[model samples]
Target chain A: MIDNPYYSHEFHGDYELVSIGRLDLEEGGSIPDCRLAYTTFGTLNEARDNAVLVTTWFSGTHQIWRDQYIGDGHALDPAKYFVVVVDQIGSGLSTSPHNASGDNAAISMSKFPHVRIGDDVVAQERLLREHLGIETLHAVVGGSMGAQQTYEWAVRFPEKVKRAAPIAGTAQVTPHDVLFSRSLVEAITSDPGFAGGEYTSNAEVVAGLERHARIWAVMGFSTEFWKQEVWRALEFDSKEAFLEGFLQPYFTVMDPNDLICMAWKWQRGDVARHTGGDLDAALGRITARTFVMPISEDMFFPPRDCRAEQERIKNSEFRVVDDVLGHLGLFAVAPTYMPQIDAHLGELLDGPA
Target chain B: MIDNPYYSHEFHGDYELVSIGRLDLEEGGSIPDCRLAYTTFGTLNEARDNAVLVTTWFSGTHQIWRDQYIGDGHALDPAKYFVVVVDQIGSGLSTSPHNASGDNAAISMSKFPHVRIGDDVVAQERLLREHLGIETLHAVVGGSMGAQQTYEWAVRFPEKVKRAAPIAGTAQVTPHDVLFSRSLVEAITSDPGFAGGEYTSNAEVVAGLERHARIWAVMGFSTEFWKQEVWRALEFDSKEAFLEGFLQPYFTVMDPNDLICMAWKWQRGDVARHTGGDLDAALGRITARTFVMPISEDMFFPPRDCRAEQERIKNSEFRVVDDVLGHLGLFAVAPTYMPQIDAHLGELLDGPA
Candidate 1:
């Protein structure tokens, strides 16, 4: 659909891309000839009931789910179920602003159409039904923006997801969360090299990306992380070195325009829009066995906010991962949180809700 | 001293400027012919024993004390005390990178010399003794960066200060504080319009300054403020309007170079530096009857951090101002905090330690 080199459809061993065709957006626009990049492991059972959908976080590809969550004896085990990791639309591997074509050619850079979590779920549904022939998912698991999509899947198509786990994210974005997302977008757009988001290469906006990474460093982890000098764990000489070596390098490769598009969606994350601003009703529509997992120290999406929504969702369980890593605990950085997540996911997947 | 139009020495009614002569910086280098803009209110007593020294916060001038704290019945009552409000050096009205001359002429913009909180106190001390002909201050009061300077005055020149009230600020910049300060500086420097700090006007780098202001909007207030939509109190129609009308306009007039210079000083704010890096020994040097007032909802300088230092200081009391406005409570926005501050200052000035 598109000839852009930035669009990475290359199959890295098992990773594959599926064309979902033209996508009508939640807002008034449409993305023409859209495609979703995804990866799968293990065999779909003969009954077609052993499929789990894994969504990617902001600026993360499907690789994160594969590398972190999917393994023998871990949550989302390939031995038990066929796990599908789908890259969200704005993610570089998907039909992002950097790679969309046909009628969507004008959607490049700053003109990228506004996307919502609902729209992403719509695209993801088509990918599952048309490409993978998956009528229903055994479970849907995600954290952060992925968690936002997981909530959308449960709310938008209730019967499609049997069990849902939304981690370190919420069905609604609070004013504080909106403010944090806005800062990240502002950090990228304020760069003079951004040139109104028409920068030729991501390299031109490295400074803004670095600053964005710095914001993440402060907000992503709890104060105790900095107090304990956890940067030392990363084996960097100092905090500044850790920032340069880890954060800067990690974010610099991301397309700034894609980040902006994702942030817009992140800011407008309330699922209540579907039910006429009735958050309780929107959450009430979920029939899946839901587990709302929030990090105890997460300043952005605290456990209290997550618990509020979890309480509204019928047949839902609220679990807080207690870790000093804050919002980052969802990434399974420290060994302290992985077992908790694994046990919960294992219960959701193997045991009765 | 310096013929920079950016340096407003002309008296704007009550506001006036005083040349403090050449100021040798604490961190090497000298600001040749440094000038400090200040304003005075009420009358000096016959014995000159009623002098109260008030310092400026980051980006604030001498006028903040005049408008907020120095009224007939307010905290720093001009009727009962000779209130001297001195702008911190690097604040727009003072001898900052925007106005410095002589050897410091080349120190314009990013090349501005490093200045610590001790350096600002050193300059303030000279201004009080030489220009105002006041050897001792009945009290030194300030909030935020101003509070940092207040602590420096008590610890560095213990005999000169009789009473000190440092509000919403700590004597040392914690790693958390440093990260915040660093983000603000990086936000400015990352802007293409920054041109390595060689920008001609503030308007040239509005985007960066606006980003910096957005960061403050999130960090300066508590989550409760946003949750309750406190911007309505400021008569704004919406949060977006408040950002555009208040935050943007307020910061746009400020020189970016001056902000960067002040942020550099803010990052290095450790009174421990003066006492061989021993925080307890440095706090122990404070003979001034001190009131360490930290805003209850302030995430930046939490009451715990303030109380820890207060516990180490001799003749000091810790009072947490119970308010939801967070660090902004120090600005006296809500009627709730002003009375507490007024009561504290009244007792500190009138009663024995």
Candidate 2:
């Protein structure tokens, strides 16, 4: 494993890894000795019924979910239910391009196999069934790329997930989102220091990482969010300072190749891929009672797109998160919409299973 | 002068350069022997009453106006008016970082002076009065940055401009727009080949330029435009092909330093700078009969922002171009909304001045 602080995975709280041995990718490739990193909070009751699965977003670790959402009286309360926050592969903590081993030892940087949200769900299924001795999850929920995984779980193993909540993400990636993901990948690969994905250190791709962060700054938030100078509330004296201090530095710690791997999967996220490109049919297959939570001002995945997919899901209910932070409200500024999110999630977890 | 075909200026038809000789900038800088590049079509009436001034947008030359809108039966028809199209400073054909001379010889690349839209208008005014021998313009018309210059001309010299049409551009840059411009500039400067603005050739920054193009692909058009795959009309088989053939190649020919200079100007675009930061007061200063045309689907300059400013102008009318190409419909896909634009400009130019 890479020992570099910048490239290696670090985490807080208690976590475990489940090796699935050989895992097959959606786009024709295999990673052997594949492993998934996950953290558990609270306790699995004697009946093992109160379990909730949380997935990580692009460039995020399970620690973020634990820090932001897993607490007493929070939307993802660890006291009421056992919470399993799983880090999707390509996230540093998992068997990403930075840490793949054994038969997957050849997979590094550009050589990493393409991963899809469905592939992630399949691995998570094995982790839950064989490793955790869990037969069913009370709910599967997350936002952004995590939300994409939530949809995959709901659609792929409907009976396994009784409830699902997908926030700030869509079942099928829109062309606009595909372009956004493509630009992020291009930003990293275009860096001359990237050296065609064979870079020695993260410092070599710092400029590209910074540019990628800037792209997120424009697309991740709403126009009203910037006009209101919301960064000031975060103690940033100026927009430039916010970018340099928060956005740029956030990406600088992650591996660029890992980001690319995840971004490619993000672009290919489509539940319809399994159902012969029939989106309605794919969404129709979801048996879980779902809460489709889309940020009201999210430019990337607008409410209209989410609501359309929600309408197609038979047992789903659409819930709009009323916040101007756009897609980022799910992570960056959660306090603004936490109450509503908590109410919806509380109802899903507490209501009849 | 740089002899590289990729970096040198090229123009169509006939154009002239008027030397203003030591033009002072709004942001505390001056370029000695400053010159404005312009081209005129049709005859200047004996009374010089039919002269119209058209300004160029970012990275555009007078040739764009000629190819897109200036023709018989067009919005900017030259048969009834003498149309003079002026290339904005920092545009390759005009005095910019790539071409600035004299005491400002060192003002190349990142050292280029910050040029405002108002600075461009002031130089254009000199070109009109001293060289073209025109006292008043029948109308000031343009789209995008050209539109910004149109507003600058009307507000800065209300008496000289009898009519104005600013399309897909605001009188002042919004915070959202400022961030977009900042991201574009960052994309270029962050390239390793950029070398802090000391690149040997445009080839050195090709990767950055390609990334820059990718950013535009995401922002230049609306979601509907992409959903509909509008690039197919231009014979592009796929979005990637379109980006490779058109968008990437479009910016590759222009000097990266010139783009940075233009983007800096774009970010600081605020007509309110002269009115003590009161946008309403600055807009109210326009005595010209104005038509504020904003693209209906434009994410950057939405109709609401343009209409808000238009409402403050005494004798201005607000018009929306109902098209899905977003900000780019004004240039790349004019057929979708050209009829309405033609009608509006026809009435503006024909109406009593």
Candidate 3:
């Protein structure tokens, strides 16, 4: 549905955008006419107890969930359960900085209100209860920034989520991660072509986006992944070819303002705010059967950090996706990557809730 | 001696700048009137064999060597062997992009020719042989990029160095490290104020330099360093204070063009070029009693990478500096930091050469 070159990307799955009315933000602002872009995979049952909510990560949409995670034979088999994949706010498919129009036109570009993980949960809560007439989610699952939202869901509305799986993300963002997020933000704003977020198109801010992609390439992949040249497995002839062919193309299509906006939210994603900085108390509220899954090689949210939070949760299991792709193994993966992830999600869903 | 505010910081040590004169670069160019900034400690013995060469790392100088590594009772004791600290060519104190003059003005700023690690070794070789009338060195020691030079010195001129130590650096740069170096270069160049390396002052490209510093803060320091708030030990009240007071100040004063020039060289530092990509054959030429020292937590040059190179050398030990400071430990230290480093050098000095 997105036609603007500023946010060009291939997201061809059928989705519907529903208005959630005027939704207020956690950071002292509100989206005038907030919207949620989502798509459902299966039919909702009479009791509506067979529904699952899959959230998207930074710069991702429901399309990726359909392509990589959802299928007939997968753990999240669409035929057996109602699979609702919702695009996170600021994602191009949703009402983002580049796509705001009509009554919401005033908040276009850099004028968009800052969004938080809690704001996203509230928005999705409205989308499901008001639009789809579903009061409870049978399961909630996501990775990276999506994982942050999954944690927020379990802690903020404990009774709503029956099962939760947050992969490659910590409940409280680390100081090291805050600086890492800050660096990504700096990379965009410092580019001359950014022009204070008034640039005409993605091409105008290509250099800044390129720098952003370079940072992601460094931290998203593990040391051994690069040292061993894993990109060759994906048909990239050389490191330079992989960089030029793979990383840059995905980002050059994205809007700079949207990326920095998401980065700002990502850095401040600490669920501990729910219980006055007491992380133990915040995690103790999670009634959902939880699986704290961290990729063993992920530098952003290492397994040790994930395990610390898992230990604090009353009934959470610490699971790991042993992939050298690190934080980014969710996509561009080997044949076994999806199965390794699905096996855990399957166990979580197939178990007692 | 480097008083130009564009490339300014505290360097109070008295150094003599000598003209090496028309040093043709390995990367197919030349510093028309090449000069090296150097400072010497103690007297060279009458045998002309008690000379020790200490090289500087990226963005470092002889002043750092004078302050942290050398002392009367230290392993590099001024009361014993003559210690010569030479600033690497692209460093501000040496013949860098910001300070090129006389006949070399044509290659100033972006016009500066790309420098190689082999180029630095050749420049130092000339300084010791042509300027000081020294034929052989008692030892050659350095950290980080200086470590690359140490490896180059031992491999290129096997008979010149008696003992060699390369700390937190690899003889052949890894592909992962090449991307890291590229990101740093892109950080500086992408800044609008850089103006294609024609910035009037360091202040003009401050944002870019700040980006450079942020990347270093992420990778130069270990993850546990930020997680445990290690900066508190150095009297930094907060993470913000540590960033503002420690990292930013050091880089914001440096010339962007000069930093990128060094980074370009750092990425291409492969001694394996001597034997056409054969690293084992290249490292096998080291006849010096060698110690390949790697900081246990250094993300830049991990111990595994250093150990791989050490295993190939004729007579070498894999020494681990079990410190948490990571790559930047070369400058910041605890009480035992120097003694631990001194112990290694002392044992190497006392052993058979």
Best by TM-score: 3
Evaluate residue B277 in candidate 1 and report its C-alpha lDDT on the 0 to 100 scale. Answer: 96
**Pairs of colliding residues, candidate 2:** none
Ranking by DockQ: 3, 2, 1
C-alpha local distance difference test of each model: 0.83, 0.84, 0.86
Candidate 3 residues A233-274, lDDT tens each? 989999889888988887888878778777877898989999
- Per-residue lDDT tens digits for candidate 1, residues A1-353, read 22334345442335687788889998988887787889998989988989999988888877667777889979788999999999888887777877756656778767788888888899999999998889999999999998899998998899888999999999988888888888888888877788788888888888788888888886787766776687787688888898889877888877888888888888888888889999999999999999999988786787878988999999989888888888877667777878888988888888664
List the DockQ of the predictions in order.
0.61, 0.63, 0.74
TM-score for model 3?
Answer: 0.96
lDDT of 1 by residue, B66-142 (tens): 76777988867878889998888888787787766665577766677888788889998898888888998899998
lDDT for predicted candidate 1 compared with the true structure? 0.83
Query: What does candidate 2's lDDT look like per residue over A1-353, in tens digits?
Result: 33437533343455787798789877888887788889899899999888899998888888778767788978688888899998899987778887766667788767888888888999998998888878899999989999899988887888888999998899998888999888777778877888887788778889888878878888888877787788888899998898899989999877888899899889988999879999988888898889999999887888988988999988888999898888888774646688888888888878865
- TM-score of chain B, per candidate? 0.95, 0.96, 0.97
The superposed Cα distance between candidate 1 and the true structure at residue A204, in angstroms, equals 2.8
